[model samples]
Target chain A: MRAAVCIALAVVAVAACACRIPEDPDGTLDRVEGGVMRVGITESDPWVELEGGVPTGGVEVRLVRRFARDLGARIEWVDGSEEELVDALKEGSLDLVIGGLTSKSRWKKDAAFTRPYVETTTVVGVPAGSSLPDDLDGVTVAAELGTEAEALVDAKTDADVRPVRDLGRAHGEPAAAHDYVLDDLGLAAGTELKEDKHVMAARLGENAFLVRLERFLLGRSEEIERMLRKEGRP
Target chain B: MTDRRETEGPFRRFELPEELLPEQRKAVRLEWLTLVYMLSAVVLLALTLGQSQAMKAAWIEDLLSLLPPAAFLIASAMRTRDPSAKFPWGFHRSVSVAYVFAALALLVMGAYVFFDSAFKLVTAERPPIGVIQLFGEEIWLGWVMIGALVYSGLPAVFLGRAKLKLADELHDKVLYADAQMNKADWMTVSAAIVGILGIGVGLWWADAVAAIFISLDILHDGWKNMRASVHDLMDARPRRHDAREFHPIVDRIEDELRKLDWIEDGAVRLREEGHVFTGEVLVVPREDDHLVDRLEELAHHLLSLEWKVYDIVVVPVREIDIPSRDGRPRSSAVGEEPARSP
Candidate 1:
């Protein structure tokens, strides 16, 4: 009886291993590996930018280009609004969508999201060449109203948080803004505050595609940071 | 003064019949063991629940599996309690009550899961079970799920075998029902395996199909156990653990009573109170001399019949309507004992 049970278990194990490639629900892996890689894009600046109604220079654009080249597939970039692109992704007309979507995007329920490939950190920074405070305990920090940076500065530090319309016009006070804004606002980066994790979306049930895409993103974390830095520079 | 008997140290009780004490001890030990092993299985299956519909159903089933063992243990504590001022009939019926609760849990959850799986089939929901990162290597999550399922399922086969033996020896309906559940658990695990493998091979509806079968198994166990326990509560004749067939000892008691010189006819009426029997033996006496002494002696002799004949009374009746008592005509409760020959 024991040997029979052992034999049964061995049979089960062997049978499971037989499916070498966990078959995709929609055959996304087989189609996109050597054929047209259908990419949908919307205007989310610094990740995807529309130039003359076409997708042009952005960090995600660069990543998608490399991904397509590596898979030996031709890229077919379809430019549309976010809603249109997401609808297209639903119908399987588009393989993936990239537009600075976060891990917590509303589209999360409608599609499969890759693990956050990049985390954009927010920090309280002083203008360049100004002495960095040991702590923001007594400092006044300016952040855009109704933004995560405003909430972060209020919670993380004892600074007098000043909500502003924009940080573009320099407020001499330490400003709570995204780390990517350091060069644009001429601020020396300081203590970090909040993080906005950015992710890419794919048609749901395309497990093989999602896995491959996530693997690519995870394997080249540093490369993504480099592109993010260059693309976000104002 | 405190009264306690400890043949098996943990399954503590007071003043059980000498013959049945060991069987009760063995049943209690097996039940405790069931709780320990099932606890492990529930935890293991929970960790591997991942995202498979079949795994979720199996995990929930394992979680609920704790109910019967726990109910048995709790009822065992109450089953042997002496009759109190408020509850003058003793707590012997606790086991039957516990059996109903466990069976009801199975039936209700089985219905929910069955419909849930069927709904998934109708909606064509594709289960998105994919690869997971383990120590920097991507492994198929199905392998881990199946491993946990196998671990959860295999032990029940052996455990079920042990449980059925004890169930019969102890005359425990709850244990018998739980044993049946455990015996069929392997089918649930095997069906889940095929479902997971089916998903691996890109058949989306297979997991839901397997879940339907698993729920049906649970439902069948619940229905059978519910019917038996309800019959017992209704004061139906004491049945063997296998159901329908009356316990042979019920007839044996009647045969023992008829062989005496003073009895012209006798009919045994017995109802199960948990693991023991309690009812009256109706007899028509042939002689009046030494009648009281003889009936008392008969009751004592019936109590010693290698079973938990905990409470029985031999009454001298003018006539025992054999067909009525033995057939579908008698609806009298244990309360009416023929006024004890006015």
Candidate 2:
């Protein structure tokens, strides 16, 4: 019995020695500083536009790029659908998700959003020669699936709502896609549907990344406003 | 002439009850296992902290619970040491002391948890929890909390169950108390898990509410253990589960004493010293010429019981009836009255 106890104690000591040292108490901050920051990006124009199948410059893309540089880390972007991106953020696979996401998102419970960097209104696009209605009483309004515009139309309008794959092509040739489709399709921009504050989403409780992004957005509001006017304006 | 028997202190090497050796060995083994379990629990707890307030509280409780098994292990080892000049009753009382100490530690921890959780509830403090991003997936704080609860809770249940039978067989109150703590530990962890899941579901108060219930359970266990250990330390006769009656061993001793011819009547007192009993027998000896020899025989017979009755002073006396306040004679039944048992 004595020998067994001695052996057990010795084993315990060795096991204790071999035990993993606890991770840094400030996990998110340490992770950010450890080199790679995984970012989830959805395909949205003027925020995360694709050029020849490669992600190119956009308002949010540039902002996050600077933010990543500030953290002394390079961004590793994972492209997915908005819901998939939010799910990835919640599962800790993505540090942050960007692509013109808004502060008021259905996935807010699973992901934390930075303060709004830009506020834009959802507008109805009609053919350029068509008369726009004050209210969508009998209009056939189209919104992309899973977008705030879909929710806004559902809540505020008694219109014949049509769920579309691409809002830009909803009023024109199905293959046509552009930054703002109203002019290209000879459609007219109509009444503002809903105002949304564009924000960046991060994994819930990734306070370090969220705070840093919020601070960067706050500090660079003027620069972002200029960038929006140049490329984000519609 | 030297009094050879007088040299035998209460600490003198007395044979352990033959049936208890295996149980004692089992108890030792169980304690070692408990120690290992607790050590791993501590490691897991450290790894799992900062997940949620409920998780943190459970971890702290786990840390505090390490005391009982450690005290039991040391006491169990020391309790078998032979009697020395300094400790006349041998080291058996070390078990009692360990029991009291362990109980006191539990009480302190329970009080701490109770107050801390109550204060949080009163202040309406919502603990801030973080999510860990794994492989591009955001895992909510609740999943981590569930993982932590399972890690800390499962082993406690096993250890608690493993120790209980050994505690009962050896009649080791300290080990029994430790086992009870281990049992309570898993329950506390479960409550913590519920609390964390509640937090996940956006019921901010659920965590504190669950914590309060956990604290209350701990406090209840603490009070019970403290009362039992304190009773043991005070040399109170060990009682049955009903608490109103003495252990059946006391009844057996009294019945056997009453059956003896020379022991016309007797009063038996039994008190537990650690795992054994030590007491006195006041016998109303019959008018026999060999009264001294009869008294010795009765003492030997009393000691021979399987109840670990290590010390018995057989005092021979004449019947003395006391009158009640109303002038009626009071019945003197053996083992019916309270007396000091050392």
Give each model's whole-structure lDDT: 0.78, 0.67
lDDT for B129 (candidate 1)? 60
Q: Relative to the unseen true structure, what is the Cα RMSD of model 2?
A: 19.8
Models 1 onward score TM values of 0.80, 0.56
For model 2, state the Cα shift of residue A165 in Å.
Answer: 61
TM-score (C-alpha, index-matched) for candidate 1: 0.80
Best by lDDT: 1
Candidate 2 is graded, for docking, as incorrect
Please estimate how well model 1 matches the true structure, expressed as its whole-model Cα lDDT. Answer: 0.78
Tell me the DockQ of each model, to 2 decimals: 0.36, 0.02
Clashing pairs in 1: none
Per-residue CA lDDT of candidate 2, range B1-342, in tens? 001122256443543565677777777787787788777877876765653556766876787678788887887778779877888667888877887877777778778877887887796554445444446454544565567677777778778878877766665667777787787676787678767655544455667787777777767877888898889878777775324456777778878976777666676666788777777777776566787777777777777675566678777555424332235664664433434221
Tell me, by TM-score, which candidate is best: 1
Instruction: For residues A122-148, write the lDDT of model 2, one tens digit per residue.
Output: 666655566645666777777777776
Off by over 4 Å in 1: A1-19, A42-62, A78-88, A99-110, A113-143, A148-162, A167-199, A219-234, B1-29, B286-288, B316-342
